[model samples]
Target: DASRIAIRHGLPNSAALPIAQHKDYDRMFADIRDKLHAKSGDPVKPEHLE
Candidate 1:
C-alpha cells in the first residue's frame, strides 16, 4: 500500500506493481481519494503524507 502511494506520486515504485513511473500519479491518487472519501473518513491528503 505504501509503495503504491509513492509510485502513484512519482516518488518511487515498490516491488509489487511493475510501475516504471508515476505518469499520472497525482490523478490516480485523486481518483482513489474521491472513492475513499465517498465511502467514509476524510480524503487522503498529502499534507500529513509520509
Candidate 2:
C-alpha cells in the first residue's frame, strides 16, 4: 500500500525504487526531486497513480 506513494512519484519499475524491507524514502524522494529539478526548477507535483 505504501509503495503506491513511490509509484505515484514515478518510482515504479525504476532502478531507484526502494526495497520493501528496507525502504529509503530519502533516496526515493531525492531521485524524484532530482528528476523534476533536472527537467525544470519549477516544483511540479507528480500526478497520483491509479
Candidate 3:
C-alpha cells in the first residue's frame, strides 16, 4: 500500500522505506508533495521546510 501510494505520486520506491520503518506517513507525504512542485536544481527554501 505504501509503495503504491509513493509510485502514484511519482516518488521513488525507496521513499516508502521510512514510512514503513518509522510510520511517519504524514511527513513523508507532505515532503513528497513539496518536492514534486519544486523545480529541479533549485534549493529548498526555509518556508518549504515548514
Q: Best by TM-score, which number?
A: 2
TM-score of each: 0.30, 0.31, 0.28
Q: Give the Å shift of residue 28 in candidate 2.
A: 0.1
Worst 10 residues of 2 by lDDT: 41-50
Better candidate by TM-score, 2 or 3: 2
Measured with C-alpha atoms, the lDDT of residue 36 in candidate 3 is 64
Give candidate 3's whole-model lDDT: 0.69
Top-scoring candidate (lDDT): 3
Colliding pairs, model 1: none
lDDT of 2 at 19: 60
lDDT of 3 by residue, 1-50 (tens): 98789799987787456655565776776677676686445666788667
Better of 1 and 3 by TM-score: 1
Q: Which parts of model 3 are misplaced by more than 4 Å?
A: 1-23, 38-50
Q: Give the better candidate number (1 or 2) by lDDT.
A: 1
Clash totals in order: 0, 0, 0
- What lDDT does candidate 3 reach at residue 15? 49
Superior candidate under lDDT, 1 versus 3: 3
Q: How high is the CA lDDT of each candidate model? A: 0.63, 0.60, 0.69
